[model samples]
Target: MTLSFFDQFMSPVFMGIPLILLALSLPWILLPNPTLRWLSNRFLALQNSAIGNATQQLFSPINPNGHNWAILLIPLLLFLITLNMLGILPYTFTPTTQLSINLAIATPLWLATVILGMRKQPTIALSHILPMGTPNLLIPILIIIETISLFVRPVALAVRMTANLTAGHLLMQLIATAGFVLMSNMPVIALNICIVLFLLSLLEMAVAMIQAYVFVLLLTLYLQENV
Candidate 1:
């Protein structure tokens, strides 16, 4: 079916995200795993047992919400896909690639780690972070430096993703838009540019997946550090 330029733009926002999310998550959804299976059986066992029986599995054999992470994926995956597609849409920028949005997501994640660390070990947290190996005089200065470095994690994460996505997107736009602009006067040059744009689009698909993986990996590392 024929689609207007506006429709093409909206297609990524509306259709592309849902489809891509579903495709990427099918492995987790469809694949049978021990976690879900054990929970399912526990669920059935509870229904069959009496009121006195230990059926409520909040912090025991089963989690409060069995396969809840899987459920959460439905939204997280959707959001990520939508963000990726946002840049692909015409006359629009990817919010995910914006420093503000990236910092919004990253800052909280890092802060959560710090808070948890503090809660787990009130005095030890500071000593553990700063350590006893350093000189006494340097303690205050080191802490100040370390504190700034810790907070800079989100800023780094935000800039890294935003810059990468923006650079790649600008490259794509330059090729595609420039090709279209040249079509009137320089037919041969326009044709060559179109080929370059086509290649760039294909490369972009790979980049989209790489960026998603990198983001998730960084998230995991941050969680591990604090938790």
Candidate 2:
């Protein structure tokens, strides 16, 4: 029974084929396509406006060279948020809950920023390892520490998303199970649990949106340092 609670995190299979592919593609299918008309429908217009605003805010602090990344980053932001929101629905899988997927998404992007810094400004990039002023004895130790911190950034990014989603899902599942159990023996307690579950669902929805934004925002900050 305990294992059943964790089964939700596993990728579902049908006739031996994993349905994760379908889960990933589902969001794109729900999006509205552009038409030939000069004026878009309300849905498209609202989407365009939101994307425009997000792009403006994301790129404002970045250098002109970094602006080229908007094409990649903006789509990633949308994809993550869509997946997160969809996961909140019943009978849906949350890909971001998987550490492998999150790491795959984060590591390459983080590495790209690091590589860009190395290629464009090798001295400045390496200089980040050492402080402006340090005791001669501490220089080596500081470099090692900073290097470890640098490498840990992507790991932290992946873990942060995974941990937050996993915790919320587990808590929701526990509360829901309790509500069901109490419904048979204690009507009043079950009602209270239902109310708490409703509030928690709302909080989880907010978390879904906020986590996606934070992931993109941190990537932007990393790019800002490089470019």
Predicted structure with the largest lDDT when compared to the true one: 2
- lDDT (tens digit, per residue) of candidate 2 on 54-104: 999999999999999999998888898899888888889999899999999
The TM-score leader among the candidates is: 2
Q: What is the C-alpha RMSD of each candidate to the true structure, in Å?
A: 11.2, 1.4
lDDT for predicted candidate 1 compared with the true structure: 0.59
Q: What TM-score do all the candidates reach, one by one?
A: 0.60, 0.95
Error of 2 at 36 (Å): 4.5
| Clash count of each predicted structure | 0, 0
- Name model 1 segments beyond 4 Å from true: 1-78, 91-93, 122-124
Model 2, which residues run further than 4 Å from truth? Answer: none
Decoy 2 TM-score against native:
0.95
- Per-residue error (Å), model 1, residue 137: 4.6
